[model samples]
Target: MIIVIVALGGGVAGGYALSYQQAQQSVLKTSVPKELAPVIAAYETVTNNYYKSVNTTKLTDGAIKGMLATLDDPYSVYLQNNDKTNLDDTISASFGGIGATIQQNHDSLSIASILPDTPAKKAGMQVGDVLLKVNGKDVSKQTVSKAVAKIRGKIGTTVAVTVKRGSKQATFSMKRQKITVDTVTGQLASANKQVGVITISTFSEPTVKQFKATVKKLRKEGAKSFVLDLRQNPGGMMSAALSISSMFSKNGQTVLQVEDRNGAKEVYKAGKKLDDGFKVTEKTAVLIDGNSASASEITAAALHQNSNIPLVGEKSFGKGTVQNVGEMGSNKELKLTIAKWLTPNGTWINHKGLTPDIKVDYPAAAKITLINATQLKPGDKGSDVKSLQQMLTALKVGSVTVNSQYDDATQAAVKTFQQANKLDATGTADQDTLATLAQKLSAQLTKDDPMMKAAVDAVAK
Candidate 1:
């Protein structure tokens, strides 16, 4: 009997007898017993029909690519010759393209971030920018891989991209080049302040070296309190995560723990030279969001569990599984899940993400009223007037006298502060009033607090 299968826009026919006999002989070589012949024969009969139809054509490159696509796993698709070369170059950290991270959103694609000092950043591409068209063609209907192919090209080539940022649509003609992204970025949080912020985009091959150098530089700049931003970091090398965690930990401490499939557990410890010159400050905070994963989680967990550091922002995307890339012959590779990782305290933060120690949400609407306070206008009344004037003066609303008076200056100053902080601007500190007042007071106190003052005062120390 003959069976025909159609795929990749082509059709081929193969004889069942010939394909089945070949599968049986191949299985027999694997030492299958005679009693299992019927079961093995049945399995091969179905697979043979599929395989033969795939190999029916002159065994061209298209057949192999099509066969892999039938698997329907995005990460399991076969890379074309050119794509294979590009993949190698990307993992090697050298690629010719506009420097941007992209992710598939629904049917369209969006820019996750534009790397600093790259063409995309120079061209003004921002996060949440929805890619609508590429080279004058509608990209809203294209797959992520198809759009990537359209966007990436030879060095010095130019590609036009149209994106929608919020309600505004803009086009940018970006010139592609060999972009090498610095996985680490560091700077003093506020030059006058002694706080430092370092943003690690990924735990790539060079991350450990880069992170060490960055910390040393920041420390020299009088950075006493640090904010390590792993907000959108998706993670990379495991060794890099261990090395990074070591910078903040003392010797003979476990950074993270891993459990293999057979229930075997291993604890990864900080090296003897860990924290060589960097002092672990008690006020360190790790910034994380939904995108931070894998190695980033490992670092965050280590700090939160074993140290005094606090984690801020939203929960992370928990991907604690360790994957081992196995080379299957013929230039193919299989990335298989091997083990799961736990925090130093033995919490399995997989699927269920790491919760923040402090959760703060950005205000969602402009119409939200924060504060409420009633006052008399210029040329007004008695006891109420005295109370209003006193409150306004206390809030630094104006320089006007508060002796049982209602004045225009006080109301004007109140309105200015309200509007500046995105409040209702009614000149009344309404429902949202106390929170704003508290925040202002906190900020003021933080600036002159004895701890911060001492840290800054010891610039020579």
Candidate 2:
């Protein structure tokens, strides 16, 4: 009787255990979708055996990350809650870092350009600098996201960076801080006192407002000519470029025309109102380089064809393709090329960039020089400086020394020349200054400097 009772007890306990296992299986079967049931069952079988012996049940974070890594798209990344918040701040154009525009080149990351006045620039970071390591870790195998995560930190904190510039490996200790990107730099040029020099880095939301204010201020200060510099601009918001271009053109003028693959065309036009308070009557010149692209090209094309603004410098970077950012589910986004743009004269500058009306190749020897000052030196005094100074004196400014020394006196005379001509106080002799100077010097000599002579002839026309 005692043996039989023990057998019955064992049977009851075994039956209870079987029932519990069936209940757990039923729950999982109901929870998993039909298509995923086989996968879930296989996972459960392995995990169950492991859990039965080890008593551990939670999934590892690394396992989750591994699943995300299987996706091939570079932009499709899995971010934790904390990382997601940081990324949002970065895309919103506000974050703390060394202030550089960076892009990934395969496994290697390269610096596109160092923002002016940022800690990166202050630390001597330059365009084309290749990042090698961060914080003592080898970043050669890391993704751009991983490298960026290691580089970014709280404002006022210091981070170490290793970069390869040509043959040398450079290490810099950079401080992290909030970087306010100065998109537009404006000043009055001494060469054409009547001309305002505006260099736009990128077209952002605030750019149009800033540009309008600068135009108004420059006109009040007596600027009658303009030189717009769009060199090395990678382009930005389309609306911003349109707004800025509108400031220079009359109403109903097309700034840019977009044509998609579906045969649909859209024309962006300028508003009738001029922002300079007065009419834009001055001759305008645009300077473009190989790095100017997209919206930068739009601005150049609009003013060039519509307003007949003469473009100087090299041909622009041919990137007239437009991209639209499409948001997929689960924070995944796609930036697909959607359309191509054309100039007002129906020129497609996709692979072939816009050719300058006046092409000026940067001298091979002058590649390292920062400023492009055109004034002649004391020893080389027969150039345009003496002629420009004389022209300035005629414009009611006091007589200049015209000694060809770029001394304090020369700079002062240039400033006075700029003031009389109603230009910004930048003492550099630019296209406008050279143009006006050529006109004054033409009376003294029959032979003309090629560029100055052209400018004088254009102004006369």
Candidate 3:
């Protein structure tokens, strides 16, 4: 038996479906088509007559990519090695590793955030710690993706990580655990305790279960109305979406329509097969942003069209096509667009995102750029310095002027921020300083997120 994973949305973040079928004979046993003879001839000529020994695998991968390029579809791609591993980790939303989000700006990689109760947090790995080595391999100059590849391994395996925290260096060794990320988070809205705000980051296989559990728990906490936040959710498994959409839909209600290449349409509905019969009868509102796509769009549209739930925020990320991911072994995979998905009303959102019923844009502070300068002293002057100054001004760190020059005022403000945040008061914007500044700015912006406020207001009304 062969199993294929079908998906919808942007490549990395999309809706997925599992399909099982009998394994077919390999194409190698069959005769080649006449049209592919030229390809075979080119391959033979390259390997047999080339000036140097040819890497057959490289030639094969390039040919596959060239064929996919003709489709001009970004979702349809050939992933190799680290890219393939990243995709699998993203889809599963679980991995065996020290749980932390690594960020790479320029040549430096550092811990962006550590998941709670994970090995990284339990091992006392703090944010902004500059990654120096992973398992004795230097990753200070590697990209975040490569660093993550090195950090992840089989569960129960021990890995050593050395990082520079402030002016000191520390090493931690911990056994990797199978970390299942909590994609769905819920709490009573701070503005309105009666309103439960549930945010689904992505639609993974475990997302539906997590969402249900959150809803149940929130309902017990005196939540009357609800806010479903799908902002920045790139979508996930189709089963999860349908099951979640069903929570607000009646049994047998149309959830979405899938049309294959042959133009045959299949309707998916909320019932025993796709839904678990759990329903949310409270008044609800949905929040969507430009990054909400595929399964996110599906659930948003379902709630809006089925139960008249209002969608608040900017337009969604338009992505309605479905893909099938085929494993080709050798740490490679081929993701190909296979079908088109539509809303219950049969609207194709491909390239045309769903318009929110109530549009609310993010505040300017939310767009504050990150400081990427490795170090900025009193004499530095550049765009990076300007960004630091701008962030400082926006954060109201001090009465510092927003300019390209990192003068004495900027240094004083940086020092003040460092002292307040418990960081070393170096008076210079180093990696630790810059990362802390970014995190603080982000936290402040999130506290006053206008979109979240809008969603709560919509639910209240």
Q: Per-candidate TM vs. native?
A: 0.59, 0.55, 0.76
Write down the worst ten-residue block by lDDT for model 2.
Answer: 83-92
Candidate 1 per-residue C-alpha lDDT over 1-461 given as tens digits, one digit per residue, 9 for 90 to 100: 88986453222234445555766676678876655554545455554555455442323334445544665433343333222212112211355788776655323467755555566655545555788888889987565567677888878888777787655565666778887767788887553557766778777666777787887788898777677878657676787788778767766678988899898998888764544444454367787777778889999988887675777767998888875655544544444457898888888988888888776442221112211223235566565455445444545665757565555665676577678778878765343433344345334432333332232232313
Better of 2 and 3 by lDDT: 3
Find the 10 residues in a row with the least total lDDT in model 3: 15-24
Mark the 10 consecutive residues where model 1 has the least summed lDDT: 363-372
Ranking according to lDDT, highest score first: 3, 1, 2
Error of 1 at 74 (Å): 7.3
Model 2, C-alpha of 359: deviation from truth (Å) = 1.7
**Candidate 3 runs further than 4 Å off:** 1-31, 81-147, 151-180, 329-331
Per TM-score, the best of the predicted structures is: 3
lDDT of each: 0.62, 0.61, 0.77
| Candidate 3 residue lDDT tens string, 259-341 | 99899999988877766778888999999987788888999999998889999999998999987878988777788889999
lDDT of 2: 0.61
For model 1, the superposed segments whose C-alpha errors exceed 4 Å read 1-18, 31-96, 101-114, 117-133, 136-158, 161-178, 273-282, 362-461
Candidate 2 local lDDT, 247-282, one digit each (tens): 778877888889999979998776644233323557
